[model samples]
Target chain A: MLEIINLHARVGDKQILNGISLQVRVGEVHAIMGPNGSGKSTLAQVLAGHPAYEVTAGQATFQGRDLLDLEPEERARAGLFLAFQYPVEIPGVSNAYFLRAALNEIRKARGQEELDPIDFMDLAEEKLKLVEWGPDILSRAVNAGFSGGEKKRNEILQMAVLEPTLAILDETDSGLDIDALRIVAEGVNRLRRPDNATVVVTHYQRLLNYIVPDFVHVIAAGRIVRSGGRELALELEAKGYEWLTEAVPA
Target chain B: MSRAILQDYQALHPQGAPQAGWLGRLRQRGLDRFQETGYPTSRDEDWRFVDLAPLTGAEFRVGGDSPAVRPEALAPYRYPGTECMLLVFVNGQFVPGLSDLGSVPAGVTVGSLASITARQTELLGHHLGRYAPIESSGFTALNTALIADGLLLHVARDVQVPRPIHALFVTAGDPAGLATHPRNLVVLEPGARASVIESYAGLSEGAYFTNAVTEAIVGDGAVLEYLKIQRESERAFHVGTTHMRHGRDSRGTSHSVSFGAALCRNNLDVVLDGPGVEAQMLGLYMGRDRQEVDNHTSLLHAHPNCSTREVYKGILDGRAHGVFNGKIYVTPIAQKTDAKQTNRALLLSDHARIDTKPQLEIFADDVKCTHGATVGALDQQASFYLKSRGVAGPLARKILTYAFAAEVLDEIPFPAVRESLEAVVMARLNARGE
Candidate 1:
């Protein structure tokens, strides 16, 4: 479903992701774990067509389409979603309105009929229960004055609404409490279908307990140093990233 | 040519005309002041950024016979709902057949200024020119000198108006170089409460000028909300001045929305005359093409314990120019006054420009006042965030711009008004193309 070959990227003068390669099939969950500034989040952002991260080298393909050649919006329309680590606070835009716009945009791109506000609300009401949030949050400004946990839940809510074919959750578990983490994970877990894929990028293995991944890759200094089964996350959690850093070739 | 225009206006009435009396004296004073001030040049501090050459160069004749307009033609501009008394005017003259007062409650008088009878003369005389200081600006003085028609609203003490008053000014004609001065006076007695909406629109595409002034007095403990929306013909020019005076413990609010006219300038001055007063001023101006919109607002905290908040936002596209000058003055006796002012502008094109000046004059050390101004394009990150969710680039820009303008539009207390304004804003954005 997704493939990245030597994905070398940079922001301004400094390079971040260098010669990173990854592959994932349908119905498979991949977890990319790394220390701080190991290009874990950078990979997620670059795959989503973030303009700040220049793709200096390499090619990426998603569902047989050139993912690196698409714009951010084009990537989204192509069923690629990126749950931002820090969801932006867009004051004056109601959450319900934002969600409806995003959903309708995706629907229209796929040659499907757009849902009216009333129908969209009905659809959103069901998704609201997935995040254990009431309808009041829909009327409030998007992530304005929201707690850290609420922002994470909002991101998960977007994931549920858009229903992308491939989603990259970049450190979504960083700011969430244990309960919020469980709710977000459960929401992601329920949306997993045989044709769609998800990439969970994080620093810790606690999230894997909820939505267990099929593959865990340890990334250091912009390169995936090790690839193993899900047990690799537990080993890294117990030993810390220092052991992985030392094991990587200089 | 300049002298001929004012000379022709002054020639409309004879000197010491018996019908004029005190109004004649007031008009004479206004005319003298206007002649002395003339049209302000860019060298003047207040008029530095706004160029009035297009407005001043045109030879706009004084009021002529207003063209007849059907009541149904104004249905679009009318606010939805039942709690409003509609007063329609064409060419600055009240259209009685189109107006619907529907038996206003006792102590509440809503009528045309030209129709103020002998019994209501004292009421109009007391509050007409008191709040609007004519010596401050040439436009106000000109409006005062030539003002002969507009809306007159007066509410007695302790009387809460059950319905809002809607004053609609529609200019319908292709009359070349036509001009009209509309004057409005609203007086809410002690403890009285009411909301008033003023709309300025044009029925035809013509080169005309509308110079309007509205003076409002909110008595002690009273509450007044005034909304002025300008949607004139693209070829027309509009200049409006609104003055509000708040008495002890009174509250006042004004929302100014400008979206039309070749040249538009609005002056809003609010004076907190007594303690415990609250004043709020919110404005949104979306200018495109060659349109130029300027808003100058001043808040005077004359008494202690007064609070004032102001937020003005502008969206400029194409070669449009937007100007905002917000001034807050806290006097020595205005201790403990709290004042905050913010002006933000979004420039969608390289040629688009915005000149913002925030002035704060504090004479009292105990007051808390802050002012800020910013000019920039839409946040690329925020835009990308929306676009990343499947929203296209153009839609993303529209959404972000809409959010910026909503900061002021959301402050409008009336949902119906806010919704209609939102539609207008969206249409304006869409008209700019993808």
Candidate 2:
């Protein structure tokens, strides 16, 4: 479902991600773990088409489309979703309204009929329960005054509502409490399908226990130094990235 | 040419030096003040950010007549889904045929200022020109000097009008380049409550001027909600001033929304004369093209235990200019006063400009006063968040801009007005193509 070949990116004159390659087939869940400033988040952001991150040299394909060539909105319409590590707080815009706009835009792009307000609310109600949130949060401003846990849950709620073909969750487990982590993982676990894929990027092995991944890759100094089965996550959690840093190419 | 027009306007009035009553003296004093000050230049401290050349260079005659316009022509501007006591003024003259005063309650008077009877004149003599003195500003002086037709609202003591009173001033192009000064007087007796909406619009494409002044007196324990919607023609000019006085334990709210006119300026002043009063001033201005919108607000805390809050926002695009000057004065006797003033501007284009100045004159020791202003472009993070959700770039910009303006727009208590203004703002944003 997703492929990346020798991806290189930069911010301003400083290089961030250098020569990183990865592939994920349908029905597979992959976890990319790294230390602080190890270019793990940069890889996810570059794939999502954030304008601030310049792609120096890279080629990425999602569902047989050139993901790197599309705009951020166009990439979204092509079934590529990026759950931001820090969701922006937008005042005066209700969560329900923002979600409805997104849902309708995607629907229109796929040549489907748009839902009215009543129908949209009905659809949102089902997704709200999946994330263990009430409908009251939807009427409030988008992420305004929401707790860290609620914000993380709201991102997962959006993911459930949009039902993207591929979702890249960057640092989704950073701010969640144990209960919030379990709920978020449950939501993501419930949405899994044979034709969809998810790429979980994190620093710790805590989230891997909830939504177990099929593959775990340890990234250090902008390169994936090791790739192994899910047991590698448990090994890294016990040993930390100290051993992985020495294994990088000098 | 401008001086000649001013002289001709004075001569067109009744051929008398001055009458014997206070109203007559007010008119004469207004003329004297206007003659001495003329139009304010940018050199003045209050007018530093505004250039009056475009308004002063044009010659606009005093208007007292209006051409015939169908009633259906005003349907688009009417407040939808609300049955308001509508007062229509065409070229500064009240049109009885277009006005509907059937909903006015007993002991409440809502009609044209020109039709104020001798009996009602005595009731308004104390509050008419007291709050909005002509000597305060040049435009107020000019409006008072040439005041022709406006609304006269008098709510009896302890009476609350259930329906809002709508005052619509339409500048018809009967005589092109016409100017009209409409002076409104609103007197709420002790414990009285009312909601009033003042709207200014143009009936034709000619470049006209509407100089309006509204003086309101909120009696003890009275509550007043006032809204001003300025939607003039693209080629027209507008200058409006609203002066209000609040009594003990009274509450007053003013919402000023500007979206039209080549050049528009509004001055809103509120005085908490008695103790335990609350005043809130909210404003929103959206400008495009060469349009310029300026708003000046002042909240005077004269007594103790009073509070005032102000929020004024501006969105400028396409080289438009915006100015916001907010001042809060806490007198020595105004102890335990709470005041906050915030002015924010969102510049959509590099050439768009905004000038904001917040002045705080606090003489009281036991008071809390805060003021802040921010000017910046759209938040890139917010934009990217929306765009990544599949919303187009243009739509994302529009949504963010609308949200920026919604903070002030939400302060409006009328739903119909809010919806209409929201639509107007959306339409303006859509006009700027992707």
lDDT, candidate 2, A38-79, per-residue tens: 899999899888989998997898888888999999988888
Worst 10 residues of 2 chain B by lDDT: B1-10
- Interface residue Cα RMSD of candidate 2 after superposition: 1.4
Give the C-alpha lDDT of model 2: 0.88
Candidate 1 scores an iRMS of 1.3
Candidate 1, residues A57-120, lDDT tens digits: the string is: 9989999999888888889988999999988888677899899999998998899999999999
Best by lDDT: 1
Give every collision pair in model 2.
Answer: none
| Clashing residue pairs for model 1 | none
Interface RMSD of each: 1.3, 1.4
The top-ranked prediction according to TM-score is: 1
- Error in Å for residue B47 of model 2: 1.6
TM values, all candidates: 0.87, 0.83
| B1-434 per-residue lDDT for model 2 (tens digits) | 25755674566455776454766667777778888888888988998898888888788877645778689888767885777899999888899999887766997988998888466768667777788987788888887777656999999999999999999998775546788888999999889999999998876876788889999999999999999999888778899999999999999999999998889999998999999998889999999999999999988999999988898999999989999999899999999999989989999999999998998999999999999999997878788898889987677988899888876787788878887887888788889987
Kindly report the docking quality category of candidate 1: medium
